[model samples]
Target: MTQQSLVSRRLSSRATRTFALVSVLFVTPFIATSSANAQVYTRAFGYASTEPGAFPTDGVLNDPATEDGALPARLRRTTVALTTTEAPGTIIIDTGNTALYYVLGGGRAIRYGVGVGREGFTWSGVQTISHKAEWPDWHPPAQMIKRQPYLPRFMAGGPGNPLGARAMYLGASEYRIHGTNDPSTIGKFVSSGCIRLTNEDVTDLFNRVNVGTKVVVLPKNGPHIAARELGPAAAEISVRPGLTPARPAVVTQRAGRQAMNIPVSSAQY
Candidate 1:
């Protein structure tokens, strides 16, 4: 081969290698970004925590107008099949599934997304809705206060309270079926030991069940079918991290009688 041709060939080889390296550099970031987006969009299970700075504008409980913005659509109230043998009016909490089902009979049940007790705090078994309250007060127990010193000793019932709209005491245990100001916590296991629902859902449930309603909490390995069905398509609300105070319900003081629209903040267990 001619000396000039040999030099030209070496230059061509170097040029090819340089082009390949440049192509890889440009494509790698896009691939990584696509993978991250896929993970976020295709997440079908619960979240560790809500996205920060997520909250309703008015800070009210269960304001239909505002609730849609704060909570994901899939996590909101839904109706599903009840394959269990439990009777009607029974309140069933599937902790493993992070869902609560109100048996409506005929193989149907109204389901609600919920936040169950964290790891060591979880429990299961039968209980009764021995008591129910609307806009219930929250007096954090001594133990809870010790664990979360930032928590208030007593939180009055109203908008911005941690225990959203309503609460139902579960027998004599420290736990209660209640509402949470943080709707983002739904479908997660972050609560101390209580079952939490959206304020709107709790109020709807509170009105339906009396003090003596039967409450059956399923075990961790319990029979549940909802989790397998829920997916990103169902989760319309995006999860926001950080603790933003939930919006409050609109209340009007008229004739010295306060007529309050439904929405709750937090409850104590």
Candidate 2:
């Protein structure tokens, strides 16, 4: 070959090699990201049934509110004097007030505004925290998916996941005390049945509590109203008038408190 032809051929070969290198560099990251997502799915849900294309490329499944404009000041987290016979470290969910109290003993508790179950979805009972997880994955229950077919069957946990920063599973039940992506949902009756707190509040609660923590969910129309009527000292009083007053019941001390007769509501996400 002529010298000029040899130079041209050598340049073409170099260009081809550079193009191959660039292709590998670009494609490798995409592949690694996909693999990492798959692994997360497997670890979270114990199965990788859904295809990668089914997930949002941005890693957020829902359109979360950019700001907490709807949140009310009263619903924000604060420490307050609470009068409850229940021991410290217990969680008291006053559904009527849309509030959660982490009993701190000595007439004090850390209170947080929360989103409780909507009208027909309210429940009352005592349950222990069976499990706890951070950035928990979501598998919308069958009933929820039936109601809202547009919801993803499974969503990997992140800022976009409805379960938010942390989750404390209440007993073996589907209900949980968890964080919410939408801060506006706090202090509202929006969930199907689960209790929701702002991500920051939930994270703080999560750090303070642990697995097997006692959770007392007062009825939707229960103690909080009576507390409002009688004062903070009446918080532990059961709403059922005929029943004798007693301490808020725990799993181990059911006989001490009047059993909540409210019907259990349906499970939520």
Candidate 3:
């Protein structure tokens, strides 16, 4: 073959190879996305929502401020060691470390990143998930309203509202384990007194938790030996009921002195 013709053919072949590689690169993500959608990673605590593309679009739960944001992998939901005798379905909040654990028995728990109270606003105590709500309405308590007059007196549940997707009210003290519109606040010390999880994380915990789920909040500066030692957990287990247990004396007094009387609200935006 003429050298010119040979050169042209070689160039064409190289171009074709390049095109094929580019094509695969372009299509791979879509294929992976399809597979991901089909086989969503089920979260612990029986979270019904799937991962990857599962952000809600409803006005109440989809906060535009955090639409594109993501929680750090460390803060995202994962099963980890939680060596507690607490029965499965119990909720434990490690406020100092910004982690929440949903005990699943068998020495495992689902840990989620959380935002806790700032300084004097912090509190610790045993509380029950007295109530659960999806897209719950927000009523700025008299105290919160006085602090932020610009905040609406009563905002119906929606995307921008402080409460993101789910709420697990903490007994009669007005604290709650709730989702936040501002996901950036996760893993920080910035709430009034309630524990804040990302919308997705809280929704997962909400699905598995019941009204009477015991919530133990470790005090700021309290020892979180188990939560700190946790690594990834293996195998899936169903939530089972066991003995209703006593409070660990180790976690009792962390928030005892600082437990404030703040009324329940969405979260501090």
Score each candidate by Cα lDDT. 0.64, 0.66, 0.64
Better structure of 2 and 3 per lDDT: 2
Which residue pairs in candidate 2 have backbone atoms (N, alpha carbon, C) closer than 3 angstroms, thus clashing? none
* Residue-by-residue lDDT tens digits, candidate 2, 1-269: 69999999999999999999999999999999888876665343322224434323222212222222345656666667778899999999999899898887877777778988877778888999988887776776656656665446556666556677678988767788987755656777878788998766677688788888999999987658222221332253222221111221111211222111122343221
Superposed model 3: Cα runs more than 4 Å off:
1-69, 228-269
Model 1 agreement with the true structure over 15-118: per-residue lDDT tens digits: 99999999999999998886665445223222211222232334455474465466676566766655768898899888898878887777777777788977
Highest TM-score against the true fold, candidate: 3
- Candidate 3, residue 176: CA error in Å? 1.1
lDDT of 1: 0.64
Please report the TM-score between candidate 3 and the true structure. Answer: 0.62
How many residue pairs in model 1 have overlapping backbones? 25
Worst 10 residues of 1 by lDDT: 254-263
The runs of at least 3 residues in candidate 2 whose Cα sits more than 4 Å from the true structure, single-residue gaps closed, are 1-70, 225-269
222: Cα error in model 2, Å: 1.2
TM-scores for candidates 1 onward, in order: 0.61, 0.60, 0.62
